[model samples]
Target chain A: MATSADHAAPAILNEVNPPELPRAVLVENNRSFTWITDKICGIIEGKTPAWWWVCFIVACFVASFTVAGITYLVATGVGVWGHANPVNWAWDIVNFVFWIGIGHAGTLISAILCLLRQKWRTSINRAAEAMTIFAVVCAGIFPVFHVGRVWFAWYLFPIPNSNYVWQNFRSPLEWDVFAVSTYGTVSVLFWYVGLIPDLATLRDRFMAAGNKLRATIYGFFAMGWRGSNRHWSNYEMAYLILAGISTPLVLSVHTIVSFDFAVSLIPGWHTTIFPPYFVAGAIFSGFGMVLTLMLPLRAIYKLEDLITQYHIDCMCKITLATGTMVGYAYAMEFFIAWYGANPYEGFAFINRAFGPYAWAYWTMITCNVITPQFFWFKKVRQNTALVWILSIFVNVGMWFERFVIIVTSLARDFLPSSWGYYSPSIVEIFTFFGTFGVFSVLFLLFIRFLPIMPMAELKAVTPQADVHGGENHH
Target chain B: MAAQPHGLIATFETAPEVYHAAEKVRDAGYKFWDCITPFPIHGLDKAMGVKRSNVPKFSLTGGIIGFCTGMSMIWFMNAFDYPLVVGGKPYFSPMFAFPVSYELTILFCAFATIGGMFFLNRLPMHYHPVLKHDTIHRGMDDQFFIVIETRDPKFDAARTRALLEKAGGKDIKELEA
Candidate 1:
């Protein structure tokens, strides 16, 4: 072995001629980890005027007001918002299912995509995982808060109680408790485990004493990793196993969540196809949110090189695939309703398209189905501006998708005598805003504290990190 | 940053250098040193004669424990403790237990694997004999170096230095705490 002082030029270093890096890119100006890390920290803080702090500040305000609205709703009751005679659980259920469904894309990106050996996942998996956690937290708030007796929420879970009332295992709501809790727990674990190595890198590089401390803490959780072959072997295996676990979870969680609506005897709501349809829709919306979040951050952070057009292109493909599936599901549901020869089901389908919420129905079709077709074009998919706009449309479309499923089906149920129109009150609107606030605040905090990209995973795939030769996708 | 005399410490610029040097060192009848590299160099483990890990055995045991635990827990929860007729369904139906049981099997297997790995590797203590070695920190980046334990039978400070020098060691130093 060569001694430290007598070292040969490393293969990675020798491959590239010392390209003249821009002076403005402080990280490029230095080769040492110490210098590069300090620059990263500087970029994170307002030390450099390069950041769009104005947008972040405005986002913070929007998030805070959302919190205020939530507090107001919680202080009052569900009655403060919506929920009349027939449409008692409209926006709340829709939002709950919608957010939960959106969360699936994160775990799917991080775990399932990783298992499938999709290298592009490394670019956005961290952010997606963070989104998953935040989205679950958002999803959880609605269910608990919607119950009104938020304090007695534990009744959902089975416990040894004085009242011999055994929680019904047959109930889909009970299954939801198990599924959502498990999803949240495992996703958090997966996210944190994935973060360990990146945190250590951040710790080793940054000058901040707090960062150093955090890095140390993260290092401890990182299991004193030295990138040993022994460690990597097990770590890679564990990641594989986690991804395997999460793939089914991504499928099962939303299926069970959809069962919450489907288990009911309601006309349009109760359908055999709801499980698969909802799962597809969830992944679609979740990917849309991922793209929405990634595009802005990639621009703001100047991480275009790291995030690349390739990642957006891949994510757009998934969005299109899922969008088509959802559209197919829409057509299938209507066909099934017509074919079933059930009058109530047929009428429910008819009402959804031509009834009071027809605008919402058309919006869903346009945003989720019609607009996403543009993504099939390579040029349109590569265009960040177009992708961002499409992502926003997908989100709105999916929300209306949930709204149509929940409110439209319930408003005119089995009998026309009990049919009624449901509209969200100011409180419901405020509470919805508040949930966004909570989600945004959590996401902001996550970005500031954690590496938005999995540095270690990226390093594994980067050309410099490879020991055994493979073709570089870049 | 100065080498303390006991045996030779050499740092290679790249992984290939370390591999080449390992073959040379083995041929030269030096068997006392350890190689440190930024990332895994294939075949190094065989060259180093490190034993096969026992983590799998521990993981297998953990998995068995998990499988039984999952079955028993469900049996206890649904069958023994609270035997309520759910949906005209039979109590302790194994089919319904698939999801939770599947989850537990994975959870336990993972726990056991990690736990066994840690126990076998002697990790999380932040103290190691190798930390005292010079150039060890550089192993995280683009360097590949080996520290021959001076206490080994074939180790002689001077002889080791001569052999390493002849083997194209870039920077040879006697590392000490």
Candidate 2:
């Protein structure tokens, strides 16, 4: 019988084994190492494109509203927004969480995927890391202005005071100050270190072009990198160490952010699962933002071969996976609320779905949970336009998720008499929109001046550039 | 004025070619020699007989300092200086101390890594003897180079040139300091 089954197994195996598909190249167009560097570096070396200026102008115009909003808020007070008695933490906190969550994908690509040896990250990591820095900057702006008096913001730090008052280290808010600042600092350092060799490339290219001014400027930032083996050895080690240290931060920064809500005694906010949920949600929304940025830029820059369909597909799958995790967390939250039989928690979940903020809650569900599920189809994953559109939906959905979480929880408390409706005032709306402007302006400037892709890294991944794999050797 | 001739620089078309040349040069017991490439070549360090970098060790030391600093700062500030109790949590809670400690560890480790890299490589030394060679610019592009310094103990011009030529090196140039 065993022999008979063995004889039958070949037939079954033949049926199960799919036809061999041609392996996809991460860098498309069979681009040579020299071509990779020349093409990517050319973007910075050439005159700034007119569209870049147009986009930059628009971004600057939008970003100016941040100044306007902050001025209005300062001149008046926090009262300009809809932070009433119960809903003290409304749009400001919501936008803060949203932007911070958006920042996570950058580090996730640069650090985590790097550790995993995912070479696909090389194409997108530079831009994504820049996005991370800008997003964190946008994220930082909210909490500072939310303090009502920005000058006293130093009180958040544990600097010794003459009056003998110290910040409470036990508070998650204080932990946020440390976590976010450290994150920002480490990200900038990591980005600059990665940029050095590429900057040197730019310097050499400009020097060859007889542009001494550009060469001098780039050379200053390049730190005189000569690509010496001695330098390469130390540089590689430092980069690896930075990648190792950054990995924990990718998880912890958002976990600590979740702790700000989880440590609270509020019915919906207090949960053990908040950390993982927030992290998954962060990566989910982050990939959404990355897709939104990369899709258009890839088309405009004609970087199709570098930022290939393979990369976009993989990113879509990640968004789908993280979105599914977010959906599961939403379900778990509801299930736990019901299972625990706590009136406040149960009422909070129900109110989020059926009460006054039902529209926001359902919008979050539709955009984040439902939209990404479309990516399960191969065709949908491959379609850039559709993916871009869906990514926008995910962004909108994530914002609503935060809105629903903060507002719905606070809108109706334990006592029915204390229940109140919450809505953002025009100032609050403009302030939130202004952050996008700031983020865009910074990102636009980065793309204009800097090597948006890591030329060295992109070269490293090309076929002929492989040190160990010499099959492509000329 | 013409700069002093520092050494002979030999260019290789491929990584393996350079790796083999580095091995030959290293086996010949040449010190004060260096390989330059557009990117870090795997096994090239072994070929060049390069020692393991102490950057990680510096990072570890920095991380340890950071952990201690984080713990002590929290303890001294919250517990020792002004013991204000909110939410009835412990004054010196290790649980509360961990996030700041973790962030500081990463922060210190990152700083130390970059600092150690620069220190170990003797970087920010804008001028180098090799930079005077025009062909050396390709080292930042798609070329490989091995320069056996004139300061090397085994630096005979004829022997070094012969060794590099035998190792498939092309475009051998005598660079000035």
Candidate 3:
């Protein structure tokens, strides 16, 4: 009954108007669906490698420094860490800012990139988010201990007490308390929501392998995810909403962090540019840390096909872009200091460049500005060893930047007599250095027990996962 | 009816197979059914006739409550109760209260979104009949499944099996309750 004309298909237009450009495959080597699941889940299922033991032991040894430092300081007073008359806020503030800045890259990757539909983020978001949480843990110690009376740190929250004095809601420090706690809480939720499906996969794997205890443990956390389309319809919406809110949250966290300095009347710190500059530098330093951590991981896991050269290139490009923005901020800060004609501000900028702290300033400039420029070249980004080394420089540079900004401004203030050099004692140095151990210990435990990359997300990006068989995707 | 086999579950090897099968089943006028997949497949919601989630409404409501809480708490503390001015500024201004309110908005919104997702999905269910299939673990890995509940008026043992098999489903079987 059908007409012959209806059965005959129209002649295809062979003349292509717009040329199709090739995009790099997010997951290389044409990995199968099961391969992705097995690869990520295998990390937890397999025996802990020897290097993990070595790293754990070394981390524990280093972590002892923080324990010892805190113990000595608490037994004595905060005075043991070299907080004298002029420089009450020295290494503690610097280390706090540095670690917080390092936390930014993780949220930016997981939230901002996810919103932008950058599929390469799928391979790295899990580890990056974990890094964000751990870095926040490291950053928190400094502020709590810096309060001097660690027991009274609970006063930071808005709780009714006998003192009858409410917190100053107008204060930037109060804003910081709200911002940081919210950032931490929301990040944990986002990370946990993302982990549910992957955890279910782990639970099923363990159930199949006859590992009852592991299955039960994983199943408890998975919250009974059955991969139902009915559930996924809601689950995917939750993930999207989290990503939506998180983009603004990530930006606001750094802005509030910058407010800690900018709200103060300090000459170098009181710039309108601080918010954007700090956010950019945070992302730059964060990517640096990510590269530093992940390069070694990529090699150890042989995840070249999963991670791929394209992901590295994308990260390098973002580092380059953010680094340039930071450099522009530096130039603008100098320009404004001179252009504003404020003697105090001019002197602060001049002192930072040529005064006693010139060495630290130059170290920051060299590491932050010059180091990221190398990523502009194809050869540099492609060379993993070089990229990893540059990432270390980025970390060092960002740290020195915080040190320079804090010390140079406070060390050489308005009064000549009050201006004195501040150097951290051995106790301060050890406590700051010990944070790396805490971060590593937590991170190592994470990679050992949980899926390091998002298996469910990675499967979604592959060609075969496409319901249409992804014929045109190539 | 309660003790009878819970449903017939049809398993498929790939996304496309299951996706097409979902369309066929939906067109067949089955009311109580669902698709199971390792990860969310694009447009599968449309194939299965599922409505979009209403979690955003919960998030918006939560944000409004959080913002109001932040505004009132600051106003009561700084402006009404034991007002002590610091920095010579106004006793309470929305200008300064903005940051805390913004943070609360995000926090409450996130909590509501996640909580609503769980509530809507009826998660933490711990057990379901579809879970007891011999190779059901594959549903959380590479395999896909379409479950037709026995509660549906249109469900018949032989008819559902014939339809699933015709629709390219493999390993079609009834799930134990």
Considering every candidate listed, which one attains the maximal DockQ?
A: 3
How many collisions between residues are there in candidate 3?
Answer: 0
Q: Candidate 3 clashing pairs?
A: none
Ranking by DockQ: 3, 2, 1
Candidate 1 regions exceeding 4 Å error are A1-57, A206-223, A468-474, B1-10, B15-75, B85-92, B100-121, B129-177
Residue A6 lDDT in model 3? 62
DockQ of 2: 0.72
Give the per-residue lDDT of model 1 (tens digit) for B1-177: 665445557877755567667767777666566676544455556555544666667767876887687677667777878787876787776766655555566557656766666676566656455544544545554466767767778887778777777767878876654
lDDT of 3 by residue, A250-325 (tens): 8999999899999999889898999999999999999999999999999999999999999999999999999999
Cα RMSD for candidates in order: 7.8, 3.6, 3.5
* DockQ of the candidate models in sequence: 0.22, 0.72, 0.85
The superposed Cα distance between candidate 2 and the true structure at residue A395, in angstroms, equals 0.8
Clashing residue pairs, backbone N/CA/C < 3 A, model 2: none
lDDT of 1 by residue, A43-93 (tens): 444443424456466667776765776677678766776789998888888
Error of 3 at A153 (Å): 0.7
Sort by TM-score, top down from the best: 3, 2, 1
